[model samples]
Target: MPSLVTPVLPSGRLNASAQPALPIDGDLLLRPWLASDAAAVARVFEDPTIQHWHLRKADSEDEARAWIEQWRRGWESETACHWAVADVGDDRVLGRVSLQSIIMVGGQAEISYWTTPESRGKGVCSRAVARVARWALEEVGFHRLELGHSTANVASCRIAEKTGFALEGIRRRALLHTDGWHDMYLHARLHEV
Candidate 1:
């Protein structure tokens, strides 16, 4: 059996490099969320599609600031890593990509993402997910990465496949959204040994 290796930080959290900026396709960048991005974050969440799937609305800039802080805490605690997907020239927020439910000992984590209305259909989420997955597997030493989304979300399904995650299976009534229980399709990619 192959032995597992976990990255550990001095602070007792999983070692995620301090440099959070991940470049994608020259025009896009994925970096750690900042407090100043509260307004843009709130704007992205204002999309009805984002609100429906995420189940909570960040209707105000304050709420968005709190959301950013929560993810920042997640990093300190090593529970998650969230990044702002931004345009390189203007530094405008285009979306977000995250590695949530990180378990270093288990060599696993789950991926999630959302894009602003303007960014949809542009492959922003797909490229961001692919970059994050590579970083998680190569630099962070995670062996398996999982992504699950409502089966009704065809865009998310496409992003999963585009990023090299294979369809694993579906979990009936796996997630509860505002509308009702949603059947979720789970996808995954394993590190190449």
Candidate 2:
């Protein structure tokens, strides 16, 4: 079937090249997940805050390694982009920031993230998110980037606002967690060209 409108971004636009490591600052950067970081990944999921908000866990090193592999494949599929926000000096994993639910035709993607307990309240997640948003909208040619969080996740709401993702509206009971359904706050940032 022929469509009137063309794809907003060309096929292979992302997978055509190696995924780039985006720099956040002198101390931090966004890099591909490594197999060696499995322990850190597993430990991060053990944090009560992370498990509660993310609603998933890597109970063992093997599970975390599998997740890392899956994230690598996601870059090839172009369906998702996941990065480990790490310290530049020691290369320690601090958190994760991702572009999920990507749609190439309309040039849109959803952003999601979680910071390690030790890194929380240090502005790490927000800064990493802001950097990723710039790369998505400016460097990658995405027209729109969205960040959605459960209404109860107030810290996530702050990250969205700090990254220039405007509060669009609330998605009633959009996400299910252990507690129950949650109303999600939808926020978006548009390419400024």
What is the TM-score of candidate 1? Answer: 0.91
- Candidate 1 achieves a global lDDT of 0.88
lDDT of 1 by residue, 106-189 (tens): 777899999999999998889999999998888666789999999999989999999999999999998999999999999999
* Candidate topping lDDT: 2
Cα distance off (Å), candidate 1, residue 87 = 0.4
Q: List the residue pairs that clash in candidate 2.
A: none
Q: Over 4 Å off in model 2, which ranges?
A: none
Minimal lDDT window, size 10, model 1: 6-15
Cα lDDT of model 2 by residue, 110-174, tens digit: 99999889999999999999999989999889999988999999899889888899999999999
TM-score to true structure, per model: 0.91, 0.98
RMSD of each: 3.3, 0.9
lDDT of each: 0.88, 0.92
Q: For residue 117, give model 2's deviation from the true position in Å.
A: 0.5
